[model samples]
Target: MPENDVIAAGARTVIRLPRPADQAEFLARVRDSAALHHPWLAPPATPADFRAYLERLTEPQTEGFLVCERESGALAGFVNINAIVRRAFLSGALGYAAFVPYAGRGHMSEGIGLVVRHAFTDLGLHRLEINVQPGNTASIALAKRAGFRLEGFSPDYLFIAGAWRDHERWALTAEMTADGPGAGR
Candidate 1:
């Protein structure tokens, strides 16, 4: 969307709202990242899917963030906050992926930090969680690196690919973070 919609930024990455104009490049990146995403994630790959994804973001409970390289503005990956609960809960779930060219380059690590900061500060969220399949070690590592603690495990937590998958729940509360709540603002 607008360039000014940046939620957060680091030295190498920037997180912002997804735009319709990014469809072509986004699809291509998804296609390229399919191998890495298999059995774990299934992001929007076609125009119709992308459109539907965008439409979902219009809802108050959902937010989609496109992580791009700061210097070149290349699509590094995507991180979504879904099923946000306000009022008593003030919590949200996280889902993220890094494109092939940017994977393992430490871009997503920085991006995840930015997302956590934005959720705590800008969004005024008190807690955030990431439900990742147990087999996905990389995703688990990312969550751990970003300061998320393993909460528990759920059998058949989310349906992915063709069947239900077991997942480990990782969480971070504002008070548990260094830059989170009670930090400065």
Candidate 2:
């Protein structure tokens, strides 16, 4: 995406919507990172799948972003705000993944920070949540580093890989960050 299309940008990365032009690179990255994503989440793996996934993001309640490296314009990973609820709740759930080439490089951490700011400021969301399977240490760490507090645990929160998986619920309200009500941006 062009800089103008970036929804958010950190020092090392930028977040933008996945476009049709990105299908090849995005799919290649996903294919290379399959080992890294196994048993946790499944991203778009085919052209048809990408088209379907992009179509889903057009819904009013869902937003998806691709975290890209600023220097090389490569796909770092993806972050999505899913199941957004308006009215009284004004919240959304976050889902993210770091591709093999970019894992452990801190790009995702910065991307998430940008996402948090965008969620609170641009999207007018009051809360953002992340659910992680118990064994996914990397995901849990990323959420923690992004300032999402562990709220509780769900015995069978989601179905992943096959059966129902237990997940730890982590959340961050707008008030928890610098952009809290009455605070200066």
Candidate 3:
């Protein structure tokens, strides 16, 4: 497959794994949206960190992708599937964030839907989970829109923004959705 392909929805946006060449663009977006993302995705992200981040995405144990606007070809957001476990339980964690410019346009939701499909069908994962901070209403809505059910709140689940923040766990199982794994394909 090409480095990135545009996913068709009411609004066209490209979704695919980020290549090494995209590092500069990714860094620029992070810098530009520092204020909006700092609370959740703080600074101190050096070039090395970004390089390692991209490398992790290509690793067999994890996968990640960037969302871009088709018309402008700008880096709008990112999504990741991490902590893949293939033992008794084939499961992984889902994480995503969109730039301020792309927020509330439903682009992240569309990208997430495509990634969820690929995760279930292509990756053969049985379950996916997302943890969102209690205050992140946009992210919470994205999870719901993508069919993740709210499981419960996790106290001091993650240390973000210099403190341990509470997160609400949301999950989606392949068997729970009609279009999930082993449905027909």
Mind giving the per-residue lDDT tens digits that candidate 1 earns over 1-185?
Answer: 34587778799999988989889999999999999999898999999999999999999998889899998899999999999999999999999999989999999999888988888888889999999999999999999999999999999999888899999999999998887646756
Expressed as tens digits, the lDDT of each residue in 1-185 for candidate 3 is 35335433225676777777888878877777787775765632578988888777777779887777766777778888989999778899988888767877877887888778777877889899999988887788889998999999989898887899889999999898777646777
In angstroms, how far off is 9's CA in candidate 2?
A: 1.3
What residue pairs are clashing in model 3?
Answer: none
lDDT of 2: 0.93
**Which candidate order results from sorting by lDDT in descending order?**
2, 1, 3
Global lDDT of model 1: 0.92
Lowest summed lDDT window (length 10), candidate 2: 1-10
Arranged by TM-score, best first: 2, 1, 3
TM-score for each model: 0.96, 0.97, 0.87
lDDT of 2 by residue, 64-137 (tens): 99999988889999999999999999999999999979999999999999988999999999999999998999
Candidate 3 positional error at 62, Å: 1.3
lDDT of each: 0.92, 0.93, 0.79
Name the runs in model 1 displaced over 4 angstroms: 1-3
* Clash statistics: count for each candidate: 0, 0, 0
